[model samples]
Target: MIKEQGLSVQHVCQSMSIGPTAVRRWVEQYDSEQAGQPGIGKPLTPEQQRIRQLEQENRQLRGDVEILKKGVGLLCPRAEMSFRLIDELQTKAIPVSQSCRVLGVSRSGFYEAKRRAAAPVVCKASVHLRAAFVASHQSYGSRRMVAELSNRGIAAGRFKVRRLMRQAGLKPVWKRKFIHTTDSKHDLPIAANVLARQFNPAAPNKAYVSDITYVRTGAGWLYLAVVIDLFSRKVVGWAMAPSMPAKLVCDALHMAVQQRRPGEGLIVHSDRGSQYASAQYQAKLASHGFICSMSRKGNCWDNAVAERFFLNLKMERVWQREYANHAEAKIDIAAYIVGFYNSERLHSVLGNLSPSVYERNMAAKKPIVVSEFT
Candidate 1:
């Protein structure tokens, strides 16, 4: 017993720290040393050993049946095929996380495949919504996407488009808040508040609104002066300059006059700025027989049409770009105003028609009348 246990009995004698009285009886009981040989099993034949190895391998291969069942229930597509291959690798005692890392598949994708398989419906609508969203530079929201899909002859409502947008993880670029940059602080002879938020014009050229907005550039600040026809809310003329001088406003008004050749008594509305109140600008307006109308002190709503135009310009174009200088901004902004905004973009107030289209439609609808002043 002592030999099989590999030494004993006298071990207690070596530990005298335990009092002799307590260990003395234990030593006396184990005093007799009975030796016994270590046991060894009989060796198995080579054939039996091979059989045992095969049984162990069979057990391991049978363990993969669970992974096989999961693969059977996964969604069928090229995306799921990738995950299916990952699952097969996982059955080989490989960690699922490790297989995901090796195959470059997110765990979310693996889980999403299982979810889709449970429902098993084709998502053609989501595909079209995703395509439209990508094509618009991700600028169209659910409402605009609904319109775009309808134009493509795909029947989809706003709510369905919104749902598909969420499913596809698609969202449009957000517009930053608009800032007021008009500086109306100047001592000059101002005109009476006549236009007074009367944005709905009876006809084109009856009234025009003007305003100035600032744009940041790498070089410095760039000022843009715009004159808009109140009837269609279209930018009739615009001028970009490094400084906001009276000549800036005059140049834009000059362009509007040259292009439209409006009848006499055209009321031009603007904020109370020195540029608009300057003798030079007043002389130019007088030369064209334009009646000057100014907004009251610090009242932006009086020139709301012009202010809205600037807001559209910034939110739709300028905010998305970083111009190196005024020249670059001029080219791009001119393209947006002429090529896109006025010609192609739809306005809800214009009944989803572009400004040019709306003007033509209005002209077709209304009969001509003599000038009010005449």
Candidate 2:
């Protein structure tokens, strides 16, 4: 009956009118003295709690060691990394056998993972494709991602890259609202259309583009203006101000002129915003011998290149980083431009070379051009 009803031993004993003394004596003798460590009615002391904790930690450590041993036994192969290890195998003074023992890996297991096999001429190609997939938000649909992979010297078709991306759990970023924040309707005087939508530059400092964009911080907003050299896409001059005004754009232009000292006939292009049209802004450009240019009314495409630069700047950096305030953002933006974007980051349009590198290469070819970066 007790078994059918799921009664515990204590309840079954009471129902059967049997004393628990005998069961208690049996437990005391058969069970370990350390069972729960409180013995009979005694309460556990702090020292006992500490002992229990230590025992649990020791057991966990033992389990971890066992798992590691199993993993070492399995020893999955890692191609190039294993080759490097083998090359260094006998170069050191220590015996290889002892070194293997110290490394906690069996010699046979190490060799198994290290043995050279026929290179996957095709698979290596897939890896390069995979890297592009990984970099492109991993969200590229099979066809586009595959096209991108194939374009980058990988021989794999769309199906293969798609399968690889799925296996690796990659996906491109979701499309978000395209924020159009540069408003040109202010009552300020507009600069005359000097660039006339001509963006092509034959050499460095021949044409420059300038624009203002807003960055959001925890405290509020920060406005940044940049003047980029059209020849190499380098940001020659930049300024950050609390508000967007004629002074904000002017400050950036001043810095660029000071650093590059672009001679007369240089084309400076921007939107037909009041700031750019202001007499002060036009005078500054005129004093530097730059021909001021403005985009056509209500046409963002007229200043498309400048707008594109801002889009890239936001997408590649500001969108990914968190800033506590304007000051923090300023510091990071400076580092991004001077330390990474100009000096290191590769641009596909610029033949996969950094802006600074492209500029340097161009300068080398045309030694007559005189320009300096501050």
Candidate 3:
């Protein structure tokens, strides 16, 4: 082969492992070639060059097919006959069967696509919606997504949003539940229902709702007691402990006392739970010169403010976590209650302002005595 390209006979024998006879035959072919085009190498005819180009193109196409096959195998490894079927369908121009056979997508998948025709796709529009959804921390479910779409002036229904979420494998990270955390089962003398189902407070610190909730953790269960100011809907004081003893509620009350130092007649309402009704708890309230109020037995509505707070806490935070133990739950709950709930969470009744913001607003307003001394 080398001698045919004008190499010396001995060089061909040594370099190419060609025997003497093969080298002599190649030298003979080279002499014939040089006789035709004297010392120039033989050139390929047009057909041979065309064939070479076609062969190169075929090899490149095969390489691409192998890469595509590998990707499809990785994505849907269990399924067989992916790109091969796609290519066959493409060649035959039978997209429907090709989609079903190659993609291993069922007839139903094709029908679904046909029934729900692929909408006019715009890369920019999809990019915007995906960016918005992602920027929301995936906290938005179909309802919120639909609302967002509407806000962005994009026409979309809840079902459509749900379908898109399914396609994108997205879900809302937050959920809701009915929380029944108040254990009003203490033997202590219950206070009068002074709040009287009146949750509205005309001034900050005038009325507060207290409740206790259980958060599971590694150590055990961490009990959280909170006093929410009714006027501002702000959690003034919160305490977390390993149990729901009187001290749990007492610490929370003390926090409120230290923080607000409301006038000598602030009314603090709670259910007839032992934590609140305990003698020690009542004495603490008296020490702060605060009036104690209790909800009637089994009537959660009487302490609705506290109930609502617990509900929101569970819905927004607790429901989303799997507590490993008491300590972990405490840390997460503390962060949620103090870091997010009290300071950042927007309450609809508070005109969508956080409790801190609402309290600041209330403090800005002049207090008007709506209730008079008897």
Candidate 4:
């Protein structure tokens, strides 16, 4: 009304019942709008107001486009990877919900990803858990998995390991019933249980346990004999053959002697199987000045360590694979014993250390004496 009537500012203020400053400011805004010039206050003209609205909308659209561009450019097939990108953008002042919306990701999922990333320990634990599980041939339970993580300097509790394992779908292989391969009905003289139930020895090569287990193959059953040192629970010797004969146990013991030449009177314990009680096996022990000890008839606990090893072998590797022939079974079983069991597998008895590592650590503390036995 003031602009069209050409009234003075003081007159307009008194007539309109508005303050002098308000009247003046509205007049200046109107003048600027009419002249198509920008002003500090809201535009009075419809065209100017429309322009201002469109400019604001354009700016908002540009921002949305920029966000979409970043989201699309960084987006991957995996949601986790995309969430990481969104997290990066968030640090640069981008709203997480906006980025998630543009990327077609749920806000909750993005936040979950953020929460996981916040815990580097959990992330690292997840990685180490999978690796340790795979490295263990999917045979490690939550307890051993936690120990493996601890060995790697990653602190993870059993419950946490179990949770992460369940989340990752890391289920260990189930164990089947153990098959008894020992035939104790033979006429061969059995050695007395001299070693008794003393499974843990103070020194390596002081006592050794041997056992034989059969593996199924297309060709036939392949027998495997292993000699474990009582001190380190290490497979000091192992031999595989298509037949379970006296020579098989002898060969395993021979390998054990070659690897660890124990002093005289070292106890060599085994179940009262015919192969173990055979004259050939007895002669082998006598030649090396070793004492022979046999488990009581039908008693498996006397050589429980060896039985446990066989159980582990079947559960972890043999049962998981299909062997076409003796050669295949032999190769795979050898790999499991050497590559995985002795070198990498965690032994609960040995404080979660691999057999090789336990031996090496112990040998360092007290150098193992290699006895001369030609």
Q: What is candidate 3's TM-score against the reference?
A: 0.54
Give a tens-digit lDDT track for model 1, residues 1-374: 33456654456446444555555554344442111111122344677667767876787766775465456446443667778877787789888787765555688888788776665243566777788676554666888787767666677777878888988888766676654665667677999988877888888998999988888889898889999988888889999899989999999988888777788888999999889999999998887788999999987788888877776777677778899988999998899889877886666677766789998888788864534432
Worst 10 residues of 1 by lDDT: 32-41
Could you tell me the TM-score of candidate 4? Answer: 0.68
The CA lDDT at 37 in model 2 is 59
| Backbone clash pairs in model 1 (N, Cα, C under 3 Å; residues 3+ apart or in different chains), count | 0
**Which digits, one per residue and each the tens of the lDDT, describe model 2 over residues 1-374?**
33446766697568778777765554564343455555555667989878888998999988987775556456734434444454486687656576565446567765655443432355565566567655543334676555555456556676676677667666654423354546777776666776666666778888898888888789788889999888888889999977887899999998888888878888898877777878889888777677887777888887777777676667656777678998999998888788866786556668767789888887788784664432
Clashes per model (N, Cα, C within 3 A): 0, 8, 6, 0
The RMSD (Cα, Å) of candidate 2 is 21.8
Tens-place lDDT digits, model 3, residues 2-75:
63467776876788786888667656767765444223345767776677678778989879767765677687
What are the Cα lDDT values of the candidates? 0.77, 0.72, 0.72, 0.87
- What are the runs in model 4 whose C-alpha is more than 4 Å off? 1-119
Model 3 / residue 19 / CA error / Å:
99
Q: What is the TM-score of each predicted model, taking all chains together?
A: 0.61, 0.57, 0.54, 0.68
Give the winner by lDDT: 3 or 4. Answer: 4
Report the C-alpha displacement of residue 218, candidate 1, in angstroms: 1.3
**How much is 226 displaced in model 3, in angstroms?**
0.9
